[model samples]
Target: MKLARLGSPGQERPVVVLEDAVLDLSSLTPDIDGSFLAGGGIDAVRDAVASGSLPVLEGADSLRVGAPVARPSAVVCIGMNYAAHAAESGSLPPERPVIFFKPPNTVVGPDDAVTLPRGSTKTDWEVELGIVVGRRTSYLDGPEQAMEHVAGFVVADDLSERTFQLEISGGQWSKGKAAAGFTPTGPWLVTPDEVDHRALGLRSWVNGEPRQDSSSRDMVFDVETILWDLSQYMVLEPGDLVLTGTPEGVALSGRFRYLTDGDVVELEVDGLGRQRHAVHAYEAAAR
Candidate 1:
């Protein structure tokens, strides 16, 4: 089933996408916290939806669409997991996964406007497949078991600021990655049964021109392996998201071009749907 959190930023409501209109789900329950997904909330929600026993939704138009899951515990990322993206960034294949974190506050709805942060001249975009974990898992045996813990997937724009990322600092990538408004996720969170994870293509267009394009097939460490690898380090609890990494064609993968204010970025994954964000120049806050 296709699940989504819709409405304006702070006022989002739980919604399920029907063929045309969004099915309001928040009325069935209060905003589901991350712990719900970590526990057995995923199965419960699915069962509820399937049973057609949820409360009738009212105020569907009154509430806004928040991130489908409230604040996740963490937003873990795998850098250069796609070979072509790595080459474009002038890096060699890593012997292991390149992991990083984007704090949970970066989350925003799919169509939210993205700010080109103050002092950031090299704002960039990365369209990635986001995995939301449904169960707690640690020290996973391997990819097979890791796959079992996932709740669903969402499309994400891993908005970036290259100047802060590649320069000025000590090369700690997180400095550029975790800036507020850097991650825009969802139009919907599609269940595993609803998407062909392995076959879907990820494509991104900047100002209507295609920049990055590739398939999940190109991932160096596919979904299953990535989960297993991460579990060995920290427990992945429910509602925690992992950005599986972007395909080639990022501005950093230097056939390079950076974004300017007024540019529009559109990205999509097959079956998962799409997201569009317009970039804007930063204006300093009044003291």
Candidate 2:
């Protein structure tokens, strides 16, 4: 089943998207959030759909699509999970996950307009597979148990400013990654039963020209391992978002120019969904 939120930012209402209809989820719960996921929301939705308890929403295709889940308390990121991406960025493949973070506020709708950082010459894009945590997690006994804690998957874009990430402040990557709207997630949070996860096509484009073209099969640490490894060090609360890393062919590779004003980025993961972002130059004044 596919889940989404629709409407203006901060006012979006939860929904269940099927091939033929969009069902109102506001009747079941107020939002598609931590509490909902932790309290058998997906199961409830499935039962409601089977019982024909949901009302179909009209004109949903015309509304803005918000991230599939709301109020993500933590946005954890993995860097260099793709060996070729590590090579492009002048780094060797790490023996363990390279973790960082973007403040949760950075999460935005899949189609929202993003802004290139001011005075930035190295702003870039990453197309990643996103995992939404279903329950509180810490020190799992095995990697296989970690999948039980996964709520679903979403398509995610991890935007970065290379200078802030690599050339400044003692190499703190989050500095480049925390810009507003840097994380464009979802269009759909597809349940595990619907996805292979082990092998899926991942791709991206800049103004319709191809950039990254790879697969989740290329990830050094698969979903189960990533979550299990992460749990050993930090608690992944319900509704936390984990970005599993991007494949090769980013602007940072020097094969393509970094993003500038009016650039458009499009990304997708097989069966998850697609997202497009029209980027503008950053304004120094308050938004």
* Predicted candidate 2, C-alpha RMSD: 1.2
Using TM-score as the measure, the top candidate is 2
Q: Please list all clashing residue pairs in model 2, or write none if there are none.
A: none
What tens-digit string does per-residue lDDT give for candidate 1 at 137-211?
899887889778988998998888888877965867888887787998887788899888987899999889998
Question: Which portions of model 2 miss their true places by more than 4 Å?
Answer: 284-287
lDDT of 2 by residue, 1-287 (tens): 99999999999999999999999998999999999999999999999999999999899999999999996999999999999999999999899999999999889999999888778888999999999999999999989998899999999999999999888938579989988889999999999999999998999999999999999999999999999999999999989999999999998999999998888999999999999999887773236
lDDT measured at residue 14 in model 1 versus the true structure, 0 to 100: 71
lDDT value for candidate 1? 0.81
Total residue pair clashes for candidate 1? 10
